[model samples]
Target chain A: MSEFFSMGGYGSYIWGSYAITAIAMIALLLATLRSLRNSRIERDQLETVLQARRPRRTKKAPKAS
Target chain B: MHRFAKPSVFLKLTDPLLPWLAGATAILIATGLYFALFASPLDYQQGDTVRIMYLHVPAAWMGLFCYVGMAICGAMSLIWKHPLADICARATAPIGATFTALCLITGSLWGEPMWGTWWVWDARLTSMLILLFLYLGYIALVNAFDDPERGSKAGSALALVGAINVPIVKFSVDWWNTLHQPASIVRMDGPSVDPSMQLPLALMILGFTCYYFVLLILRVRLELNERRIRALQLSGMFDERSDQEAEKANSYDAGHNAEASQ
Candidate 1:
């Protein structure tokens, strides 16, 4: 109801605090997730590249047979 | 503890706990918000304006909590040269800064209506502002250097020194004739707050704590992955000279100078 929104005439202050807190928390969470995802992608890419470059067989391979 | 400090082990231990922590954070915050806005009664004195305490107090508490965590991690990294501790300290700075800023801003919003002023040079407010600056300074100092190890060393030193302000912030109201009210929930005699008001306050504090751990885990993983990628790239750049070195570095994060720092 409009009465609750008005909050006995201190509506703006109450709502403002809640709104900003919500926004800041959400923003930080998204930023953390985005960076985490990006780093995971980067690490995976490097890993695949390293795998391709590594030797396919060990030094103690099967004798000529 | 030392065995689990290895980056790989740390990640494995924490990754499985992430979903549960995140779920708890979401649930606690939602319930806390409900109680704060609707279920709890308005203050006879301050009316609806008291609702701001739900956000302001928790943010303030978390701001201090994270700072203490950073300082402890700083000591661990300094005394034991724990790379994982260094990563944790670095990951905590931004989150702490965010909460401190939240506390200050919400406090300001509440102040304008209650005190008829938007700004004051009170002890509590000023020290809290200093805490925010400390977080910002730590983040900048840590990332300033090309050598991550050196950055961690300098950053941890700063964190240890800045810890003096946490106690000052906690006791500022009692120590001075500040406009800020004295502690109500945490006191020698026990919480003076009403049981209903305490419900939202306690829930929000727990929720914020859960949120911090969830982010700490994510950010620590990010830092570890970045370190591994750095080691991998360094090896890849000089692949022709020593193929064996590259292979060694490719053993995941083992290339991060896992020192025998006993």
Candidate 2:
């Protein structure tokens, strides 16, 4: 309703306060999520590369008679 | 506890938690906003101006809560040298800063209509302004050093010192007579607020709590990965050293074998 939007003439202040707060909160959430996603990918990639670089151990056979 | 610091374990623990927290945060915020904006009645004293309380109060609560969280994490890191504690403290800094900004901004907006100005040097507002400064100072000090360990240590010290302001901000109106109102929601007696006002306020607090959790988890996960990268880089250095050592040993053995045959 227009009443809800207007907030009885205090609409600008009320809605502005809410809107800025909401945007800040959402922006924070999105940024946090994005950083988390990026970190996960980085961790996975680092794990893979480190695994590949790790030394492999193999046993040597005894000399033939 | 250290085992949980491992990225894999952290990831596994957080995987199930993220969805639940995200969902809860969404529901709480949505419901809270609905009640706050649509269902709650306007104030007689301040008309719709009191609506700012729904956002302002929660942000103020979170600002306090986060600083406490940071200080506790800082203590853990300093005493135990726990990596996760350092990570937690680091991750929480920005979140606290954001909440403090929200609190100040909403407070200013509320003040403009009620006080005929956007800001004042009142004790509560002044102390809150100081709290925001403290948060910014902590963030800056934490990242100022070239050595991350040194930075974390310095940051912990700053966090502990800054915690003295948290209580001051909470009680400033009581300690000093100021234009800012005293506690109406939580007092020695029952809350002075009406049920209609209280419901949306309560919902906003709940929603803010969930929001903090979501942000905390995300930040913690990011910090863990950052540590993982550091560890991998160190491990790479180790592998390179081992490769060179093995090459040297192989060449020595080959030279001795050739000499013995000759």
Candidate 3:
């Protein structure tokens, strides 16, 4: 276990490369997901506002029986 | 092909694909890591430090691939004026930049231990650095203008221009004496590395490719949604402006009626 972690004395270099790659990829994924969520929220809000502003249609009254 | 260029259709088509792509990426990466760390034998030359190649090489490849993808999208946007192409190019910039950054940082990390230096301004390294700058420049140019269309146009042109660096980065080692080694896997003579190493490398490349697509689809969706919101706001502004005009006209008529009665 310790030997595996040590990586024959080049452990720091190997681990550093992997760690940075992992961090960058995760960061990008999170940022992309967050942006998607935010955009969806904004779109929904705008759509709702537009729907509310639209003029409501009226129904005609029935003739006297 | 052109049919999917519509943002609405694009969103519909890619919505179903994201889950599969993400799942494949996760599986591939896990397998690749397993193979890289445990199964692959130590290099007789570099020892365990060669493990860095698994991540470093794939990232460098992806950085180049993404730039090429961006350039193609830029061309489509510029020449044919494909609507989604610009958005795709825009979506690709940041992702490519990140990949390029990863490549550089990992390369540096690998270099420090192997070459006994942190960095060298060699042909390959310098060209890759230029690629990173190109990605940054495209991102900045795309958002610099008030008119999004104009910004996209400018960015597309810049991307097209910067594409010359891609080939330079690829062939830099062969063209000049550099601290970085020349191509090993992608040669006419075939890959020089052991089969064990190649498997993990291939898996890592595929995994990274999957991740790129997943992010690209998400970013493109966000771009489309943002555009929709902008259009909605603009329409709403137009509606409000017309309403104000109608109100002003009504007041003017009311005043005229009152004066005539007086």
Candidate 4:
């Protein structure tokens, strides 16, 4: 087990490479997912507001076909 | 290909594919890691340190892969004025930059123990650094303009220009007398790597490619939604009638898409 970890004295380099790769990949994924979610939420909110305002009619409003 | 320029059509096709691509990415990466760490044999020359090649090689490949994909998308955007292509080019930049950075970092780590130095101005290394800068420059240029259309145009130009470096980076080792070793996996003859080692490398490369697609899909969708929000903001409705207001908004959305695509 220890031999596997030390990797014949090159453990730090090997482990560091793998660890950083994992972190960077995960970070990019999370950030992209978060941006996607935020944009989706913002668009939905704007569309909802637009929808609510769409039904609003003035007293003198003409019938819209 | 031109039909894919429609955001609705693109989204409809890709939305169903996201889950499946993400699943493939996870499975491939997990299995690759297993092979890389435990299943593969150590290099007689470098000992266990060759494991670094598993991550390093894949990251480098992705860096180049994303750049080529971006360049192709940029060309399509320029020739066809497809907003989807522009969005794809924009989406690919940061991911490409991240992979390039990973390549440099992992190479540095591997180099310290093997090459006895932390840095070098070797042909391959220097060109890779340039590739990272190119990605950064594209990101900055696209966002620098106030108008998205102008930004996309300027960015497409830069991407097309920087594409000359792709071939240069690929052949830098062959062209120069550098300390960096010549190509082992991709040669005119064939891959010179051992079969056991090849398994991990191939798996990791495929895993990384799938991961790229997953991120690409999400980012493209994000850009499409943002475009809609912008169009909605620009086409504020003053119509009092409910039906007309809805109609006006839909028309504005359609007009915005049509103007760019035309």
lDDT of 2 by residue, B1-262 (tens): 5674786776788889888988988888788888888788888889888899999999999999999999999999999998888888998989988999999999889888889889989889988888888888888998899788899999999999989998898888899999899999868998999999888899889889888888887888788777777778788777766656766877889999999999
Q: Which stretches of candidate 3 lie over 4 Å from their true place?
A: A56-65, B1-5, B245-262
Classify candidate 1 by CAPRI docking class: high
RMSD of each: 7.4, 5.4, 5.1, 7.1
Tell me the native contact fraction for each prediction. Answer: 0.88, 0.77, 0.92, 0.85
User: Model 1 misses residue B254 by how many Å?
Assistant: 34
The structural similarity of chain B in model 4 to the true chain B, as TM-score, is 0.88
lDDT for model 4: 0.91
lDDT of 3 by residue, A1-65 (tens): 99999999988889989998999999999998998999999999988887777653111112211
Sort by TM-score, best first: what order? 3, 1, 4, 2
User: Model 1 chain B: which ten-residue window has the lowest total lDDT?
Assistant: B253-262
Interface root-mean-square deviation of model 3 in angstroms is 0.7
Clashing pairs in 2: none
Error of 1 at B5 (Å): 4.8
Evaluation by lDDT, superior candidate among 2 and 3: 3
lDDT for A49 in candidate 3 is 88
Candidate 4 has an interface RMSD (Å) of 0.8
Give the least accurate 10-residue stretch of model 4 chain A, judged by summed lDDT: A56-65
Candidate 2 whole-model C-alpha lDDT, 0 to 1: 0.86
Q: Provide the overall lDDT of each model, using Cα atoms, as 2-decimal numbers.
A: 0.91, 0.86, 0.91, 0.91
Q: For residues A1-65, what per-residue lDDT tens digits would candidate 2 score against the true structure?
A: 88777877778888889999989998988988788788778878878887776535111112211
Of candidate 2 chain A, the 10-residue stretch with the lowest lDDT total is: A56-65
Q: So what's the TM-score on candidate 3? A: 0.91
